[model samples]
Target chain A: MDVLTTPLTAFSQYFSKSDYVLALPMILLTVFALGILMIDLMLPEEWKRLNALTALIGLGFSAAAVFRIHSLLGPEVSCIPGFFGTVVMDRFAVYFFYLFLVGAAVAVLMSVKYLEIERENHGEYYALILFSVIGMMAMACGYDIIMLFIGLELMALSTYVLVGFLRRDQRSNEAALKYLILGAFSSGIFAYGLSLFYGLTGSTNLGTIAQGLEKRISANPNDPVVIFALLAVSTGLLFKIAAVPFHQWAPDAYEGAPTAITGFMSVAVKSAAWALLLRMFLFGFYPLRALYVPMLIFVALATLTGGNLAAITQTNTKRLLAYSSIAHVGYMLLGLIASDGTSNTTGIKGIMFYLLVYTFMNLGAFAVIASLRRREIIGDDLDDLAGLYKKAPVEAVLMLIFLLSLAGIPPLAGFYGKYFIFLSLVETGHFALAGIAVLYAVVGLYYYLKMANAMFMREETTAEPVKSSPSMSLALAICAIGTIGIGLFPNVFIELVNWSMSGANAATIAQLMH
Target chain B: MMPVATTFFFYFLSIIAVVSAIVVITRKSPVHSALALITTLLSLAGLYLMLYAPFVAAVQIVLYAGGIMVLFLFVIMLVNLEKAQLEERFNKQWQVALIAVLTLGALLIFIFEKGRSVFPQTVTNFPENTNTQVIGLLLYRDYLMPFELASLLLLVAIVGAVVMAKKRV
Candidate 1:
């Protein structure tokens, strides 16, 4: 009895309040998710909307927890390792946590009306959204490979279901199946790579792995195992970001998923992947920067070319945006490639800023499409947008703002996003890459304007005005304000990104610079 | 450098695993294919045992051979087999599959060739009887976060299956 009690006490002592405090946001979300599932079982059909309200409250509370952690940690503490260092409390994680929660909240707001229209309103929908956001938060904060993998799977599995939520639609079924098979395959490759690293380092803790990797690299500067692991891991991550040659699933999945979910996936899911990529490279595998930078350049060039070239012929609105998102991935990758192993934090900061802006603008664009969804019309075709200006003047103007911002026009957040990337590229003296990226940006504008032209110039295809619920309008308004606000006051958002970069990993990045 | 018995058992398990795995894909009958899969799984478990990972081998046997096999057989039995057999066995997509396989094979070979130089590091051996205890401690202590997250992941999987398969939600 004494021995048993001793072990139990020792185990209980291992987890202090700080552990739970750092993980509070994710913990709160999980609780709310479980609560929603339990509540859904008892709630009547008419009251299903309460789940959405519950989810919003959960997000709000989680956000408050994030800010609480921020205030508690203050600006001086770089990061605090929590849960035995499997996760970390850091400004970087806090920043992305806010981004994910905000993206998720707006997604929920946009989803209510869309789900109601599709006659697919259910509590599970909101629960799944919350669950996926939990996964994204984990990805943002995870400090170990195992935690990252589990987090990635959680997010992937939820989205796979969400993508095919419309069970009656055949296209949705096909897209879900495709995404599932491909995503699972990539995850397997990713695990193999991480296992190789574990074998090489004899540890899963990223800090320990970094030390081990440095030793391995110094001993055998050209270790093939390191290259193989890098390639395998990057393949998996690039697939998630929908980069070139691995992006085939994105267009189909985007076209097939519920419009509101498409918004969530494009914004929150992609940003989560970018966060993971930055963490893995800048922290665990920084010693191999010389080996990976060339690889990123080629992939970025191909992604830009393939994504823009492919988008030119797309008639469907969702598929076109999917390609455009792929192109944006290309630009961000260029930012990554421009990261010099010196104290220059511009490249990484550019990616963070770009992702922040992308969340608002892209989700706004998707929300507009979701608003166009009617009972009979699928409302995804470019022709469907004809004379949207006549029917819904306000919505059309908002859509125009989203499109122009996406096209990198001045006075829009998208332009600042591209501007930072270009500035980083030139700062790192990649003038050639900068020139090519600018050319692709011009090409991207063509397709975006194509949609805009149809909206304002063509005749009305349907007599009914675009009907959007108040919640959707709120979502649109949030996105519009965020996109325009960030653009007009770029300095403020830049400061926010700069504050996030001033974390423990910022030290790791600084080490990479020199 | 190695004991003769251990090396022979390693080769024996490898051969069986490869042969059964090949049989799994080549068999025309779904039942036969599933049975071959079980053989493949069991042989892989034996291989794991040879590597001193008894816990993994046990899990492979119980989960893959025992639990999932039952699910596979039940589904196979419920589906109408004769009508499926009469339908097209192969689609025009075989070309794409072939290309993908070739590319993957080429990559594996390339990696294996380059990795040969770094393959001869020391192999750490743990005490045989303490294997389970060590793993349990590591999972519950140092790896607790991932362990709990895995439970949540499985929950998502269950929820996803329900959402995708059920006629109504």
Candidate 2:
């Protein structure tokens, strides 16, 4: 009885502020999600394509809403109310929310053709993707550990189903089982860490946790529980990001899951996880730098070595890219480590910029792969890509741009992304790590170039040309444009990156130096 | 209730949790393994009660032990379990297991050695307020967004599960 009356009062209280600008995007996305669901249910089987169309519309509106909100709220505003203080509306979160929306939109576009080809096209697929997008948005904006965990699980559980969407396939089943078991295990570890943190800090909000850590560190200085709890939490996050030593499931899962969904997972999931990682580490655990920096550095090195070495031997293209992504994670971690000891915006900017560039090039690369045909004669082997240039010149060229970008070739988005990241490392005096990262980048170039060479240089084995859907062509074109545009006019993107990093750096310095 | 009985119960529950966890991992049949998992989860609920978090204990029993485990059992039953034909889906790495055990033992020793400096015993009374009440207040007041978002997560999970289990279009 009280609950009924209370929400009405709460609603009235919320409206009295007359400042719904901060909440407009969430409101828009929520409404759009429900609208899409309704449309999905109302549409007939043949009109199921409307689901994808509706999702695209929803995402577009949400993206526009985000821009409007950003404009209205300015850069560094926090609109927290009630007791929860769970959702934060700041530039840092807004940046990620936009990224999630764009990534999901591209993923939906990429899925259209793949789903059609596999004859597994369904409205639920689109709906689930939107749901996962909502989860990613929540995770990105979450200000507290409980919100983070719920959002993480929401995304994970949905992806688990998405991974095993092709139920009859043995590999898909295996992937789902592996993911479920490992995901549950990691979640349990994370929850235990949360419990430990709660025991020590008596709070779950990131800001409160930071305050507690500052106090505890000054008092105890060398308590092992502090380090243990930090390790456990980082371990859980590391699992999510698929960093080395915990990346065993990534390759198999990527190889087995539908290619389009794999693309979505690689970009959207990684971006969201990194967003959460940045928030947690930079905000909540900044005072414990001595505990995290060295551990992260070692993990980065291991991830680089393991990812590159494993990629060199991979026969399947998807698995190869999976390992490649792991290596990219290593590079991203370099940005995190570079942010240590100083409140420089360059390092964080580099990370954010790279994530932006990566979303395009990586997804574009996967789009090209999704278009390739095995022909039952030459499966998804390296040989299948032979003479792709002659068979499908447009795709081959687009694929070239993606591979070049990923390899950090000049005049491509990938190059600028790496350039900024390396610049940050050097600026932070992480010269040795940056040097090692360059060396690994060269090693990565080998495999990416191999794919490019196979597509562009090798002669066609079959007379039949590869066919692709118009939707895929459009998606690839968008990615190509983004990759080249960001590379050429990087200043605009650089400004955006700078703006996002300023908030993060200010918050980090304020908490750490206190 | 003597403190001795409380201590005994703690030890017994801990042993059961460990044993059940082991069984959950080792059992050949997925169904049997899932059942063992339920036992492990129940014992964990008991452990939660011992820790003075009765609300968490209740949640553990209701959500995990009752709700989630049932879903797991149902899914296991729904899937053609014959396909599993358990020859260990994962590679058998006894060496890694042995290494894990040894590492755990070493860690325990280190923990004991360091315990003196860190967790010095101080007799303190547990808070009088009920765990449920406190948690409810925190959830509704401090963690309201997360509480609401958790419902959203459940809604997504329900939608996703139905989608995945449905007949292909």
Candidate 3:
């Protein structure tokens, strides 16, 4: 009891000392989300497009706020306090806030045309996406487990609806039903785990939990209940990350959802999940490393095998990308497995850098997919993309960059992302896992190139030309610039990732050594 | 003392929960399924009461059994159920049943084998009264934010369901 009250009092004192400049991005996003919801309600049906525009304006302001906060805080500022220590304003969260805002902005841009064609364009659609983005931002900034769970559910519930946005489609309906049942089940399990953890630790704050775990482990290391609680928590996070055995819904959901929304899911949700995963594993469960490392390695292996092998046989473009995202998750887990005391910093930095690069390439690839629509046919199949270069040179070229980047070809953003992740693996002396990762990367590259070849090398089968909208073009351009820019000048992002990891490492070490 | 009666109550509620859950899955009529679910919900509430969470028990009965189940029944009736195609509502997998049985059997074995070691005997001394007031106090004082946010979530769900089910503007 004294423990909890002390933090509250100290937090209040901290808030009294601090200013609101650091919390500007979160404030902007919260107001923007509410504003968009209100505008959606107020506007007439004819002005529904205004909802999308509103989301864009809100996201623009959020991006500006992120930049402003980052500049003001520099690399060392720890923005804490506010909302009773629920939100942690720091470089790590600010980076993810920018990533999610940019990703949501691009998704909204792509949705404008796609929703029109599908006749599912409604204010609620844009409002839900914005709400989910807000949820992701909340999860990124959350400092407490209670806040984390709330943010997580906010994102999950909205996504369950978004996954089945096209109600007329039976596949979409089935996907939504499956997602809801499984997501709710996992959430229940997660909540149960959290309750147990809180009972044991006497607090739900991450920092406090870390301290408690360190103390408990040092006092008596073999408590079976602690092991069980850790397993349950890791299981819940694994479900969110779509790690093996829990990833049965991803392919179906991705294939069934709107393409642009799938892009948003692929990048934004994955990044947010990784952020929470990093915080939990690097803090709360660090003392139980012996238990988690093997479990993580096994999951990484299964995810890699499942994703890469399934992707090879996929005929649907969305499902292929779904599998590809799973494979990327496998690589991310490699970083986690390699995160021992010696190289924990590098592992986290690698994950951050990969997430940064992945946001651009994956979103850009889906943008091209969104652009591949005509009067009668939706471009969901690989054959639909046949001879895309002949139809739309710019879209095809953009897709080429995206595929190459995903394939980790040199001088592209994806290459650097892979390089950093693999470098971290090698540095941790996990040469065997690094080797397998490289081998799987080759397997992944084959399919990416197969798609690229189909686009560039094949002859035009259909006479109808592909059209690109201005919003989509702008999204693609931003993604393309980000991909190339990060590839050429990786230092700025590397520095930022290093700075974030340093804060996380210092906090982790402090708790552990105490 | 009514130790035997208490044991009987536990067995009776367990049977009720199991039977209703089965009915929920296997009943052909949607109305029957919904009613069965209400029964399951009620039995679960009773079990919660046995476990000394009288507040959750009441909320379970009122919120889930009364409100949500009624809403489910209403939706079932509101839709054109008579004209709707009545096909197999579940996956036709005979192997799945076998797998489920085997898995449950294995789980039972594992639990029986490890139960003594895994579950330490700890006596829970409850207060003389465990009711809605105590629960409400705890919720407001310790879990204030989550309780408030849960209401907000329910509000979102209400608005979302209305928007989703409504006809075009």
Maximum-lDDT candidate: 1
Q: What lDDT tens digits, residue by residue, belong to model 3 across residues A245-274?
A: 789989988888888989999999888888
- Which scores higher on TM-score, 1 or 3? 1
CAPRI quality level assigned to candidate 2 from its DockQ score: acceptable
lDDT of 2 by residue, A44-72 (tens): 76777777888888788888878875664
Q: Scored by CA lDDT, what does every candidate get?
A: 0.87, 0.79, 0.78
Chain A TM-scores of all predicted models: 0.96, 0.93, 0.93
Q: What does the lDDT read for residue A468 in candidate 3? A: 80
Q: All candidates' TM-scores?
A: 0.87, 0.81, 0.81
- Model 1 is docked with a DockQ of 0.50
- Docking model 3 quality class: incorrect
C-alpha lDDT (0 to 100) for residue A404 of candidate 1: 97
Off by over 4 Å in 3: A1-9, A13-30, A41-46, A64-76, A219-222, A340-343, A511-514, B1-152, B167-169
lDDT of 1 by residue, B123-143 (tens): 667787788778997899788
Shift of residue A156 alpha carbon in model 1, Å: 0.8
The 10 consecutive residues of candidate 1 chain A with the worst lDDT sum are A1-10
**Candidate 2 residue-wise lDDT, B15-60, digit = tens:** 9999999898787799898989999999998888777777888899
**Model 3 C-alpha lDDT per residue in residues B41-125, reported as the tens digit of each score:** 9999988888777778889988999988878988998877665437575777968987999999999999788765644345555
